[model samples]
Target: MKKILVVCTSGLGTSLAMRLSIERFIRERNLKVKVEHADMGSANFIEADLIIGAKQVISCLSKQNDIETIGLEDIVRRRYIEEQLLNCDTIQTWLKEKEGLR
Candidate 1:
């Protein structure tokens, strides 16, 4: 299973929403993955194969080791949470390619 960390400004509202949507997308696709939500400030506590976040916070987590970062600008849509979640599919593909699992 893949582990993913979702980060946002507050960690409670938009971040949580994105997490749920990702979980649902994984379930619907029958993919094996785990996702955790965190505020940009607590990024150290997160142990993930990949880190997804808004562009505003991506720079902060980009320096971390062993974790891939996906900027939300690459996936975000007009105020729709689902679009953000769907964008993770792109990250998933990138990860697979990087790990030679594709």
Candidate 2:
């Protein structure tokens, strides 16, 4: 499985919301990915193959870590989140490699 970290401003509300939404998305699609939620302050401590977040983690906290990131302009909308995620070639490639590893 792959690790996906979802960062939010408060690290609780929006993060939790996105976690739930992404969990449903991953489950319904049968994707072998593990998603975790946290605040940007704790981003450096969280290790993930892909870091998914709004502006904070992408533009701000990104410099703290060397991990690849996916920025979300609208975290509340599931459509935009799914669209952004679907368009990420990094995640796609990782998924393929993970499948191969299996």
Candidate No. with top TM-score = 2
| TM-score to true structure, per model | 0.68, 0.82
The digit string of per-residue lDDT tens for model 2 on 1-102 reads: 578888887688888998887888777767888999998889778778777888655788746445678888888898888888778876678657767877
Model 1 lDDT at residue 38: 92
Clashing pairs in 2: none
* Winning candidate number (lDDT): 2
Error of 1 at 58 (Å): 1.3
Reference-based TM-score, model 2:
0.82
lDDT of 1 by residue, 26-80 (tens): 6665556788999988976777877777777787764877566776764334345
The Cα local distance difference test for each model comes to 0.70, 0.79
Q: Kindly report which residue stretches of model 2 are placed more than 4 angstroms away from their true locations once superposed.
A: 64-66, 97-102
Worst 10 residues of 2 by lDDT: 56-65
